[model samples]
Target chain A: MRYSGFRVIAEALTGHKGWKPVWRDPAPQAEYDYIIVGGGGHGLATAYYLAKEFKQARIAVLEKGYLGGGNVGRNTTIIRSNYLLEGNEPFYEFSLKLWEGLEQDFNYNAMVSQRGIINLIHTDAQRDAFTRRGNGMILNGADAEMLNRDQVRALYPFLNFDNARFPIKGALMQRRGGTVRHDAVAWGYARGADMRGVDLIQNCEVTGMRIENGRIRGVETSRGFIGAKKVGVAVAGSSSKVMAHAGMRLPIESHVLQAFVSEGLKPFINGVMTFGAGHFYVSQSDKGGLVFGGDIDGYNSYAQRGNLPVIEDVAEGGMALMPAIGRARLLRTWGGIMDMSMDGSPIIDKTHVEGLYFNGGWCYGGFKATPASGWCFAHLLAKDEPHKTATAYRFDRFLKGLMIDEKGQGAQPNLH
Target chain B: MIINHPILGPRDAQEFVYLGDANLMGRPDGMTAGIEAFHDYLYNRDNPAGAHRELWYHEQGDRSWLVVTRNTVTHEILKVEMARDVARAGGRSK
Candidate 1:
């Protein structure tokens, strides 16, 4: 079943009984050539690309729970390449390009909206900083526009432009950056991989790794022992605990990041907007619910929930940005675990164990970097070398004092 | 989250900044601890799902650091004490 306008019409005429399940729920195989753990966006995307691009077979993705049950489904869904660092800009730009053609490639309706994103500028120094960032984006072959106060006001007149403390001065806009249907990404990649003979084993928790003489043999799971020639661990927040099975401690800490949505209203917000002076970003969904998020809970915990103070803080930021949001009734809030690294950048490299690979420490960038992270991780696994765009994401970078500290916040996972 | 401050009574947790693992306050003598110990001190921690002792700075309050013993699973604060008192009780001087 190829999905298209013709197929939709045919299915409609036939009373819509011809549709099949998106992906199969296959049982675990006795062994596989490659086993990727953590069936979130990155793991599924890696399996899809490994089968599609690298032409690998006998691939299986092991998930502890159902598909799309992780950060892939718990994000704010904003996508952009407006980074300021060389180590990050090109890679994210590549991901943005992948998001542009994702629906066509996966044969799914992902709703990749390029409604643009604006980082509001509140001060003179912020304008200068955004100028440098915009220039960096352009240099990295990504689109960026520095908008003046009038231009920003024209785009989002609801913003509090006359605040005495944090008045809106201008903004840095990227017309190509926007949101995507987050879970659809997971489903599409899972369906594509499954179609290509890749096994997706859900509810199979890996308990331990069977290492022989510093090399990988396979994994010990709750179901049973499954042999594998190569293993890739892409567990997002569980990176530390999962890799601990192999006695490798990562320089990553897990923290809870909360997100919220408002009661559905008439469509108003046309694009994604972030408050410069604070940690608040919001965009309206197609259903008119305002999706937004702020800072993390700022603690080391693996819980998938947050407390009230952070909620109040996020609501304060929203109210400060747009007083009108105060009237909107709150719908709900959720949390995702962020694998914050020492320097706030991700690590995608092989472990000391010969046949084992590790890919995590994504922090806040995991959802946005899904496609490129998978593409680069697959390239590394297939070729045993870092992809050109991801060369800086080496595990040894911190040991060699070559950290890609994008936030310029040193060695603190929580600060990052 | 609300922390019942010892001196200030119940206060919103947002007034504080979280620093993981109250064990971070125990600084080994640099001359005695080797690189391996330092590495373990800096990078390794026991992230349990139950009660955890963490440091929180009252940034919007008295600027005192509090050692908050809370359960990660339930998001419940067990106890809160000034970190300076914890440091002194363990025998230290400035």
Candidate 2:
């Protein structure tokens, strides 16, 4: 297993002679063992695993933008296996295991900090609900802690102690959960996949998929045509459009999620904090910047610009908890599009088609699931069946009423 | 420390205004009323010398006014945050 995805990436970067450059505009292959579309986290991870597990070289990953220039780099960098579903629980645990070994395996530094992440509970009902989630985490062999107000303050000194619109009465802590360097994650996967002899074609958007007699033959890209034995749609926000090329419809809607940052300040906050009472959470980047975000803007369009309310929420949260940060200048704000599924989880299963596959609909949480999603994706792409880790993330789950409704609200997927 | 002064009796901080707590009430959770009463607190400044609080924050005008809700006993909502474009006119935060 040492000749894993990380090995592949390191091998690519430190060529046999150590003088050759790692990446180039890889020419399209006439045929390959497997072809993955969308070179984001899922795409790159898919290629890396396909090479490691299946020894499937001659594989190709088509990307519309530069590698990691998509949603994979646009997430809040949160890493947690605190899921409350059946199949998702084990696979995310697999991801947590992978995150732990990434620095050693890839010869790269992902800054995988295992700082505890606590989801604050403001309402009594919410306290009860997350209490069960805490139990679930513990039962699954993951680390967890339930904290009262004094404990929360001791853990996070910057949090507002006395008053919150929804005061933090308690929280569910997953000490194993934290964050990674988002962009570095994408780059590590790309380098690893490239080292394993996988073709990563960048700026190569798939315009159409050619199918005949119910089998995928190849794809037509904006750059040119590339023949492949199989294909996957890893575009999170644009999944609907990409899958349409294969004539498939998924129960997915695209929305925009925004994040903000304040002027650089000396490190005061240490870990990732989510104000469950309010729509605010923040993490101090290694560069001394305070990175945070508010709500999801509550509208649907490909537009990646957020309104002021979200910024106000984030800034207000900072001021309330710390108070002294009021004079800290606001530096920058940004947004990214996301593919929200009906159930607040991703759908990583094979379509009815013979040569097409999918790994889309990851909520804001996909960054944590990168390694597992790719590992399971590789399994499905190799054995020509559903993966053991991703059995619940199936297409028919919705139609058959077997949806893994994590939030307990089966009908309200888009809200989160 | 600045909030421990006394206020005139029957002279109460209105609702919606975010006051940390009364100095005497120990900056008691700002005289909390429902939304309607909060709006009414904006107009009425009863001339009760004993009741005159340090800060009369009109919270209806802006949520940024939560800054006053921290430690002060009584907060007066002065102004609300204007709509999107107005903020832009004043140069939006980056």
Cα lDDT, model 2, residue A123: 79
Question: On a 0 to 100 scale, what is the lDDT of residue A215 in model 1?
Answer: 93
The residue-by-residue lDDT of candidate 1 on A165-244, one tens digit each, is 88899999999999999999999999999999999999999999999999999999988999999999999888888998
Question: After superposition on all CA atoms, how large is the RMSD of candidate 1?
Answer: 2.1
After TM-score superposition, the amount by which residue A192's alpha carbon in candidate 2 deviates from its true location, in angstroms, is 0.8
Model 1: lDDT of residue B15: 84
Q: Candidate 1 at B36: error in angstroms?
A: 5.5
Q: Taking candidate 2, what TM-score does its chain B reach relative to the real chain B? A: 0.19
Worst 10 residues of 2 chain A by lDDT: A298-307
TM-score of each: 0.95, 0.76
Residue by residue across B15-79, what tens digits does model 1's lDDT show?
A: 88887889889867799987667666676566665788999999999999999998876788899
Compared with the true structure, model 1 gives a TM-score of 0.95
**Candidate topping TM-score:** 1
